[model samples]
Target: MQVLATAGHAAHGKSSLVRALTGMEPKEPGPALTGTAWTRLPSGRRVAFVDVPGDPRSVPAVLAGLAPAPAVLLAVAADEGWMPQSREHLEAAVALGVRSGVLAITRADVADPGIALRQARERLAGTPLAAAEAVAVSTVTGTGTAELAAALDRLTGRLPVPDPDAPVRLWVDHAFTAGRQSVVSGTLGAGTVRVDDELVLMPAGTRVRVRTIGCAGEPRDEVGGVSRVVLTLRDAGPVAPGMALVAPGRWSPTTSVDVRTRFGEASGRLARRMTLHIGAAAVRVGLRPLGPDTARLTLNARLALHVGDTGVLRDPDRRAIAGVSVLDVRPPTLVRRGAGAARARELASWPDRPDGALVLRRHGVLRRAELTGMGCAVPPDAVPLNGDWVADPAHWETLRDRLAAETARHAAERPGAPGLPLETVRLRLGLPARELVAALARPPLRIEGGDQLAGGQPEPEADGLQ
Candidate 1:
């Protein structure tokens, strides 16, 4: 289920296009809808559509929710032609790295046939929609409605298929009540949203039971994958847009971001303090400039940011610097933007050794994946069967030295032993079994299994002792 979104300047008829395409009447008043409301196609293959209000004031909220690879729909009123906000909206969509979309030329009826079409083409010049994507339609005449549907179908075909088995991550884009029901509207980025399914709201760590599900203006048996869905929770309140309900252990907190930030008129060479809008949460951060293209930032608030979490960036102070994204949050500090960023992070003195393994030494245990990643697979004899590594070459050598010392101390105390016993060596090393195993697996350190233990050499088996 590929994610697609409807984006455009104010009064461009994005909401009407959504209603026309997906059959859902999304919050329209007096022939216009001014807020973002995401909806999904009921088709088995879920297609999420975020219908964002054209109002520039709500750009922060709308941009915050324009994530997980959304297809931008630029609505242009043929008669009104292209306006300043149109370029801004298109720029925001372009900044998001989703250049492909439908250039919906609305009010085709009112638009003069020859002049309006030529101007519309010029307005969307150099865009994917410049040729095939633009669909001129008048809701009243419905002249090009079928053509629009066909174009969407063709585009949706290129999207990745949604999986039912993956973790359920419903990014709530809109939360509102219709009639007596309190429903949460969100896009299914991937995985199924089912009835009675237990989903957790991220970072908040609150759980809710799904009481109902819907897609494309109608009830559906299953919903998933880049889809717009409304899930009625058993016990929930004010679910809010940009909230994610995902599988356990799939997300984590991040305090840093790697991105190439540019200065638009709205963003005047960002200063230190700004708010980051990343995947369902807004975090304040202190920017540490590493170079012109890159910067290191520390989040002012704690968020469950994972290795590859994405989001939008906005300066709360400036009205215009309100849209940015395309970043890897809480990552291992690779630079996509900025000069000397790598050099700066390196100068910050990061260890080359596996820090996770070292931390496990202090903490006692680790998940299997962590151990495997560090090359620490121990045997029944507590001898390391794999090698440990770190980013800093110095730390790797230091770790090996520590392991050798621990093994030697154990051998000296025990006297005439080929290998150190597991418990004495671990206790003497002041490390958990996992960490000890990881350290022993370092290239310079070696552990062998014998009657006692083996580190330096094989104990000479005497006939009498045998």
Candidate 2:
């Protein structure tokens, strides 16, 4: 199955194109902005259409539709050529990293599509969709619909296969009651959801069980990525839009994140307060500039955000938008005077792509699971210490030196004492576990009584020193 979101201005024939391609009427019985729709293509491959609103006031809805989709179906009317909403929709898609999609020139029977086609190509230039195939279609006359479907088929074929074994992070776009059960639907970007599988509702951390799964309007035991999914959940006491269902203990809900702008500048030009739109959730945020292009956003509410996730920051007062890519979800505290500038320099050195080794190097040491939870792909060559801890090679060496120094200092200060206690050493070094301290103990410095860290030899008695 494949999912492609519709991006264009309202009344620009986006819904008409969807209706022609799916051969199905609008299920919501109102404007396309009301809800999402799904159907099977002629090739037996199911496709879901997330009809998004093009109005400026509905920018959040537009982002929600584009956030989870891997591709898009961009529409432009032949009579209107190019409109303001068309550019906004295209920018939104680009912001969300949507690459592969087909361009549909609607209302071709009423006006020549040549002008609109050229205009779209000019606007799409230098974007991810620069090479997208265009088809002229008139839903009124049923002309070019077949070609449009064929183009979509080709687009689906080119979409990269998603990892089915990835952790589940289903952003709920719609939630409603059915009979006596609660149902939530969204596009599953990755991972698989199965019946009876336990998932945690993020931010609130409430656990819920999947009673049933529906895909392409059919009941299924399990569903995989790139497919629209509806799950009937049990114990999901007040599920709502903007909430996400995720694998338990695999995600970290954070209220602050560091991001780099991909669209607008993030310097003093941006407002101090803005709205962040990611997946199906929108939250008020406080923006603090770390650099000309980088900033820290403090969200009003906690969100299960990951490194490399793309989102939009909208300043409603200024009617401005900026495309942002997350750099760090758990950034360090900047309580000092020059800390923000120092952090900006550190972020400038980071690669655009997420790297686990970079994270390990920055933090010196971290649990392996914690790195994975941050959406970092741990490098195969990462140095693993005792237990679940992994450390940077250079950082581990530094820790050994620090331990020896601390032990020597303790002996000099308290000559009669056996040595520094292992627990104390762990605390002094800020190590998360005591096993790490034991692992750092070398030949000369050893754990003598299985509890106390001693130097090579015991210190002389106080009277012997006299």
Candidate 3:
């Protein structure tokens, strides 16, 4: 299935265009409860259309549509040209990594769409959507809707398929009870869910069974990601919009995360109060800046998330204020002064390819299984230190340099002293364990008596000095 979210100013014909393109009539009583519409392609492939309200106050809704949809249909009105909501929605889509999109100049019959198309082209220049094609469309007259559909088809073909074997992390957008079962609907982004699969509800950690699965309103035995899914649960606890349904025992919920963000033209530290929108969930949060593009978020409640999830940090008004790429889903707390800088340094040194080197640098040491638990690859050249901890070459060099300088200084201050006490050395270097210090002492330095390091080759143990 292919999904394209429609974003534009209110009354710019987004809903009308969707109805005209999909042939799916809007629910007569009101907008659909999920605020989404669907259609089928000639190839029997399904296409779902999510309409993001153009009102600025509905930024959260807009972000929800942008995050899950592989592509977006940014609508502009021929008569209204480009509006503030249009720019806001486009920026949000880009922030959330929407790379493929089409510019729909709606209501072409009302005015010269040439002007609107030109303005959109100029506005999108140098942005992620700069390459997007502009299609003049009018729902009333049914002009160019077919061409827009073709564009969506081509765009959907370019999206990379999610791994069907990965852990399922469905972001629940809506939940309700039907007959004797509880049903939850969401856009499944990864893995597959089958009937009788035991799933874990995150943040609350409740277990439930999938009695049945539905896709595009039809019953199915199994459903893979990159499609809108509806799961009927055997036992449903207090599930809500912001919670997630994940693979059993594969994920954990956390109240804080560390991330690197791109704030665009908006500058200054993030406001104390902001909202973080990831997938379909939005939560109020506290922001602590670690650097220009780095921060630590303290979420109001825990969320089931991963290390690489893309999130958007919005201002108090819920506008797209910053785009965040999560670095660490479970980060240590900052309790003392200068802790922020220390954390920032760690983030700066975080390896692009998370590996044994990163684990060794971050925690200074780790068990073999701990490295595997973090999904770090053990490099072929990795050298083991102590029992199970691996030593990063760079970190080892830094430790060696510091030890050499400190030892030299200690000997110079107290001429004829054997060496610095191991405990004193540990305290001076802020090392957590004596084992770490012992692991660092190599050639040119010797540890003796289990408590002292020989500063200058042990002075040959002057005869009978005892």
Q: 1-466 in candidate 2: lDDT tens per residue?
A: 8889998987898888878877765443212343566766667677888877777788777888888999999999999988988998988888777888999999999999999999999999999999999999999999999899888887887788899999899998878765557788889998999999999987688888999998877899999998888899866787778899999867768999988888866556899999999998889999999988889999999898778888888887776788888888889889999999999999887765568888888888888888888888766776778768888888888887788679778878888888788999999998888888878787667887788888743332368656
What 10-residue stretch in candidate 1 is worst by lDDT?
A: 28-37
Arranged by TM-score, best first: 2, 3, 1
Please give, for residues 366-452, the per-residue lDDT of candidate 1 as tens digits.
Answer: 444443323233223222323432222343345456666666666678776456565655565454454445444443345555222
lDDT of 1 at 125: 77
Q: Candidate 3, after superposition: displacement of residue 4 in Å?
A: 2.1
- Candidates' TM-scores? 0.68, 0.93, 0.78
lDDT of 1: 0.57
TM-score of 1: 0.68
Per-residue lDDT of 1-466 in model 3, one digit per residue for the tens? 7677888888898888888877775331122233667787555667787766777767776787678878888899999998998888888888887888888899999999999988899989988899987888888888888887777767777777888987788887777765557777777877899999998887788888999888766789998878877787866776667678888645547788888885453324668778899888899998888866678889998787656678788885534378887777657779999999888887876633345555556665555545543445555455577766666666667777788888878878888877878898888776667877788776667888999987453222248856
Could you tell me which residue pairs clash in candidate 2? none
Relative to the true structure, candidate 2 reaches a TM of 0.93
**lDDT, candidate 3, residue 220?**
92
Q: What's the ranking of the predictions by lDDT, best on top?
A: 2, 3, 1
Superposed on all Cα atoms, model 1 deviates from the true structure by an RMSD in Å of 8.3
